[model samples]
Target chain A: MKQSGTIVEKQYFTYGAAPDRLQLESGAVLGPVTIAYETFGTLNRDRDNVILIAHAFSGDSHVAGHYPTDREGDKPGWWDFMVGPGKGIDTDKYFVICPNILGSCMGSTGPKSINPETQKPYGLDFPMMTIGDMVTTQKALLDHLGISELRAVVGGSVGGMQVLEWCVRFPEMIRSAVPIATTMRHSALAIAFNEIARQSIMADPKWNNGDYYGGDFPRMGLAVARMVGHVTYLSDEAMRRKFGRRLQDKEAFSFGFFDGDFQVESYLRYQGSKFVDRFDANSLLYITKAADYFDVVDRVTASGPLKGGDLQKVKYLVISYSSDWLYPTYQAKELVQALKRTGQDVSFCEIEADCGHDAFLIPDERLTTLVKGFIDGVG
Target chain B: MKQSGTIVEKQYFTYGAAPDRLQLESGAVLGPVTIAYETFGTLNRDRDNVILIAHAFSGDSHVAGHYPTDREGDKPGWWDFMVGPGKGIDTDKYFVICPNILGSCMGSTGPKSINPETQKPYGLDFPMMTIGDMVTTQKALLDHLGISELRAVVGGSVGGMQVLEWCVRFPEMIRSAVPIATTMRHSALAIAFNEIARQSIMADPKWNNGDYYGGDFPRMGLAVARMVGHVTYLSDEAMRRKFGRRLQDKEAFSFGFFDGDFQVESYLRYQGSKFVDRFDANSLLYITKAADYFDVVDRVTASGPLKGGDLQKVKYLVISYSSDWLYPTYQAKELVQALKRTGQDVSFCEIEADCGHDAFLIPDERLTTLVKGFIDGVG
Candidate 1:
């Protein structure tokens, strides 16, 4: 079977047209929002067969398969290893839908997207948004697709936050949620890292107070930010195993002036440089702030219809990693406890992995078994 | 016992004065090099009643005591808590010598120092030095002080690296040594963090290829670098316990926007800004590079006079904090094993502490006991 033989034609849906617009969690209204999404597998007679897959930070709507224009050996969609036929997320079994989240730069309307009124990119003019606001846009896209109820929804990192948001705001719409390696709220350590990254970007004069559109971008600052993000994504053990103190290019260590460099340093520099090419600096600020502001427990339990000890109708399969210091296992258990208190069906698993926060994105046998069993078991 | 009443009059000793100038580890010759240092307590006639205290990155020779001009409520020396009459490394029992490490801007011939040849700040023109070079300068300072031997040498972090270097390069000059929260060489993870910090500093246009001296400094870039350094110096548990998700001012979270900031964010920003006042961005680059290039095992075991299995004349105490993930206990153990292989008398301890790499700087009773007992027992 050609799991990745399908051409990835970008599909978009516009919302907030006229009177009924998208109201953000901050009560701000987005004029007209566009969502870029991709679909895999055929929709069954019952639209309930649709499953929504959310992408993480630095992720996009391309979750599986290869575009027709791609050459041989070119990388497929982000989760092609896990979402192809007979894979963990098995596109053959479910019609998968992945959207380039709102406020992101990949074909979606975001800071770089032209503001309909000013005829210029939004830049910092882009209204502040929360994970809930992102979920609202996904919900509207589902509404347009006539997908009332989802078979399941899955995401890791920021994408996982979207899964939690979907469960909170539209519980009756989701059958099960798999929030992998993510937290309901960031800890101080996490916030500190994000702040450092944001500071790196804003420090660049080229940022020009977020109005550098159609001009020189804050490439250097954004690269530094990406370097920080890359460090957080990998565990110390993983890094040691991968690079250790090994010098770049297997060069001999010079006794004088320290000419040789560590492999890890160059690897991160490459990751940082690569990120600047595909991402917008302003989107990073907005998205990271949204992530820092995410507090599902507070949003739900603090004076909401789905308050603590209240009923939750969706089943949750929460997954965390052993070495994921960014979010860690304790945070996942805390989220599970919150769900259990709400009398919701919650299954928590702390998968032992040395890969840190990015483990969910990497293909693992146990992750495959757990996610496949959990989502497949869900009606 | 006016432990902190001793005025901190920074005394300078010039070496490399013409004919027999100091030779750097990198094979470069430095001329008219000066070391800024201070001594606590009186050096007895025996001279062996002396100890050396090395400082960490971002630290100066100010190991203890308040300057005479310092008013009430003013902060004392960095390690005033551990270096007073009745404290660890007791100045009452033995005189202590601390010189600002070479290649640092703390009154040392660093990148910010004027080039004798060019009559301008060296900046990028400054020659790179290794941890060994730093050790060499400390030796020169000790030699100039008319001290032939040291009763003990104690330091943590980069200071700890110096202790190890001293033992390796000048084993007969020290009777005992304490190296805390340090590694034989940097792990890939540690190198990655340092790279991020360097990248943050270099990203600023104000850095201007390290030629911004006597001009608009890279304050913003240096601040971001300090922020990254601050995060690494702290443990996750410490940050969580200190700040958690508490907002900066404890205000209601606006639904439409995130006005309430996490306390951690503001605290980091403040730290970043405060560091800009004291540190030189180019000096940070040089010192950190010196640290990354430190490899005691490679220096000692790989083609050196004091090769592995050779005799080491000094007793060694290696200490690491339980939560100091930057230079974790495992790294300390590795260093210990290397020493033991060389027939060196070594004692190792992984102290239980929630604080991270900066645990030694904090006033901890256990650290006090361990350091005090180690130094005194040597005599």
Candidate 2:
């Protein structure tokens, strides 16, 4: 479905009935799962030119363009700079599909989704999800679109986790894969940060044990979580360049109780406050947990690597940013090494950028060229 | 006032009567200030052997030795590993005095202290404090004890900030100074973490605008804040070695919502919960704010650098840890550079340790040797 506007309209695809429920890795079952997706460009008659784009933690299916009524400041899809007619993804030559993974709040099944049995928000009762579960659900959507073979699958961060999961679970389904700024398993440091974020949210009394629906939401907790997350998403150099020790509209130190004296503090406070308006606290909890549970080694070895078909022919492009301490270059190297162990064709690149893990989404000529070159070479 | 026990007994020194109030940096007057301190060893006849030890953010006047009736697991003192008769600080050679800084909850004039005007907890009414203010209060305690000059003033982290302040404020009073793992000014990244910690505390309903003294304290928020602080104190390598991806008492993934599946999460939770028991939430807010407000450059250039006495004569030893991202080695280098600019005698070292910002408090042979050598050289 196409809309007559600069923004591509989001389309929904549902599958699985009550008895044919999607069995979660946690043994819980979810049914009538709906996946929200947006497509750019036209699919070839054979549907062989289809490319699936998975989004990161806070991103959705809206990867490019803007809605018809979008105002001047309204953000176009996050990757609007790269996914266009002749941009990196090159909408003119390839059919690009972006899906908001399950367990996210953006028009997808998640903790915010209502439970059919209780008719209330799933909240904490939402079945625990993993990156494999997200990939499985997305695969069902591809099957529904009559795309048996995908030209490419690409993602970064948690989305990148899904991309890796796709390669391991259904290696024969995709011809090429790009997983950027992701890790096979969460590091102790990463888990520590995530746990602190979770603690920040759960500590807020407004949370009321995650049953704050139809009541005051845990905005303070969620905002704190976002503030913490935002700090990790940027490098020390990036923060120094952007905010530094600059004061926040004050001439010298306030020395007052709790004023935002530093520009960085003010910037972080703004980021935290702004995030509460758009993101759900429960969704943050669930999605972060999903990303934490992702371990490609466990999935690949669950039924023996040899039993997972002839995956040697799959082409892999792994990319990382030098300043991304959240998912540093070492993580991408680990993935490339793992892929090599399986005799897969893998190309790795570590871009020198101070933007940190968010570099994958940031517009950079090098990134655009590398992505375009990798996709073109897939032919 | 020597006590006959392994642990030095804490003594209180009160200053600033009703009319002769201590004017704070914020133009607020605070009177009847009390400082808690503990001294080890004996001061020579001329009082030329006194080595003042300033404590870090959460530390107190207790520097070394076990209390007579203390159990085995009871920590002797925050820096018990270093300050002892034969240890790094070398109580046998130098008289050691550790004072709980002003604005600290441990028997010092702080937010938790009663306001003589209202005969109630000061809470948020406590006048905003700075590292300079803390050093000034410490100097008052020394004056009351008839100690005119210190052999050396040493500390790490926030304590280090105070050490820098002493060098700039009362350079003639100290013969040597050692500021470890500290910055001349708070970095944006450091401020961001501190702001998040403050936010975590303030977001809790129990915080009650800092008036929870008579009611339930903001334990949850304080705990979350502690959790966040605890993460910054250790390096990624340290965390990997200590916790890694180990599970918390489970064979496999719990897949349950909000469960501390990872050992690191469990450790952080424990750290957070234990912190609230011994720490005052309001004091935490106030002290962290004090830390954020500390900028040595501002103090150094308040008037003319020449106006401050001959700070050039002070022997300086600035130390930093290699993996301390919170207060990285570069920060120590900056402090040394600032000292050198003023023509001060300075020695600098960046110890290679994976312990992160808390490396100073940890027992390391290199740190001990350097501290001993630096102190001995000051004579």
Candidate 3:
């Protein structure tokens, strides 16, 4: 099958029986978990060219290419800029697999998914998930795809956390790993932002304790949360260049009530309002919690790095942006240091960019070149 | 009267009524404005020993001493650390006057204050206020007190903005000016955070377009806003030191729904929940908007610096905390540069503190010394 241009459809892979349900990090189990995914490029006969792609907190299975033209807006995939036939991931040379994680709202078994026991939407009934559980669900999907070994796993931000988890969990199963603009564990500052975002959502009475499905969603709170998130994702320099002290419409200060005096305020309001239409508030709460719980130190200390094997088998490429304060260069350095201690083959680079944590999602020639070079080296 | 130790009573100064209403920067007028204030130390016969103390966004007129014990939870002044009899502002040597700004909710003419015409709270009906308007009203209070000139004006953060306004609007009347941890204008980053806070409050249906008084207030939204504000007030290092990966009420991650796993989350929630009790949401909206409109550049360029006189008579001591990214040291430096350009007598200091933008509010020996020395030199 030719895999290029756009993903025309979403695919699902389901597994795990009642007795052999997927065990979560919290000692809970989820049965018959369904994984929503999309793929690009042809799987080689050897099946060794399968590259698993994990997504960030708000991202879904649509990693690249335009959705079907029949869909309104016909928007391209979230990572459409990077994953294509001749792009950084090089779909022509490698089969790229992007899966919606366990607790995401997009076409995956999440809080919105129907519970087998109740035959109704899980809502808040969905068991709490962790980064480890998300990785395990993806691994199950890969197993069902008849792919025993993988070419690589790549992701940024929360996705990057999954990349790290993959390398440590199944050392020999992967050929390479690329985790960009992510931390092994969230800093208190990062967690604080996440907490505020969660509070914004929960504070909205419309949320109704996350059971507002088929009713009024917590759009207001979700928008505010997204607005806060957008601010963190862009650097101060970028915001200054983009919005500065420029006022919206009016040349002078309104000195009016709750008006958008600065262009940045108007921009944020727009961002927040627009975000609510495409995202789920409860999913945001769960995914951010999972990211917050991601701690490589804890994982390593509990089960030791790579168990009884050398980490040399897994090639690692760690990239961070200069202006990504959310997961700053220091965080990437910390992750690289951990890998180095395990005698892993690791290459790290801090890209010079002022786009902050969201730089990985934007198109940059330097990032493209680095990714291309790193992936080629893995071959 | 011994104006020392605990404050036994609150004083009120009423001015600008009916036809002689206080004209705002927006050309709106407010009448019969009452300024609630507190005074410390004795005013000498010369009356030239009066030092005006401006408060920050959420601060009140109570700059020092505890409230009367008759009231429950009679709290000490917000700036009790820096403005005691023997402290930084030195009540022993100079009489200190602190007035709740016109647009503040704490015993002042604000959104919560009754609209004399409507016989109900002004709510959103209150005219939009600026930092300049706040200073203008405070000047009215000073005029009512028979004070012709001020020995100095001291403030930090939004309070600092008021101090800057005092120096610019009444240059000859101020002997010295001390503006700490403040910016001449709000940066896009700063404005973005404030906008998020405002949006969080407005999102609540209970806000009722800022007319929620005599009903359930938008406590939830206001609390979330406070959480966002609290995050910006502390530095990453301070947060790390205070709540580094420490879970709340558990040894490890609960992976439960909305449990506030991290200690920082718990702290923020507590901060948010407690803030709503003492603060009015509408007041927060107005005060923050006022801070956003505080552009010293606009003042300078519009009327030209120092107008018809020299600025050499007004000594300036501008201070910034090392970790105050909300209104970073660079912003303070910018304010100093503006003063220097006009041949003004200016002193600037960046106090080495890890407490972030709130360093000025917290007790620090270095800050106290700098403040005391600056005030002493004013004489």
- Top candidate on TM-score is 2
Q: What are the chain A TM-scores for all the models, listed individually? A: 0.94, 0.95, 0.94
User: Global lDDT of each model?
Assistant: 0.86, 0.86, 0.86
Candidates 2 and 3 compared by DockQ, better number: 2
C-alpha displacement of A242 in model 1, angstroms? 1.2
Model 2 chain A: worst 10 consecutive residues (lDDT sum): A299-308
Question: Which regions of candidate 3 are displaced past 4 Å?
Answer: A1-4, A70-73, A300-306, A309-312, B1-8, B70-75, B301-306, B309-312
lDDT per residue (tens digit) for residues A296-358 in model 1? 887545423544446557888999999999998999999988887666788999999998899
- List clashing residue pairs in candidate 3: none
The estimated TM-scores of all candidates read 0.95, 0.96, 0.96
**Angstrom error at residue B208, model 1:** 1.0
Give one digit per residue, the lDDT tens place, for model 3 in A200-309.
99999888888888888999999999999998899888888888999999989877756787899989989988989888898998898888888887553333343655
Q: Judged by DockQ, which candidate is best?
A: 2
Candidate 1, superposed: residue stretches over 4 Å from native? A1-4, A253-260, A299-310, B1-4, B253-260, B299-310
Error of 3 at B59 (Å): 0.6
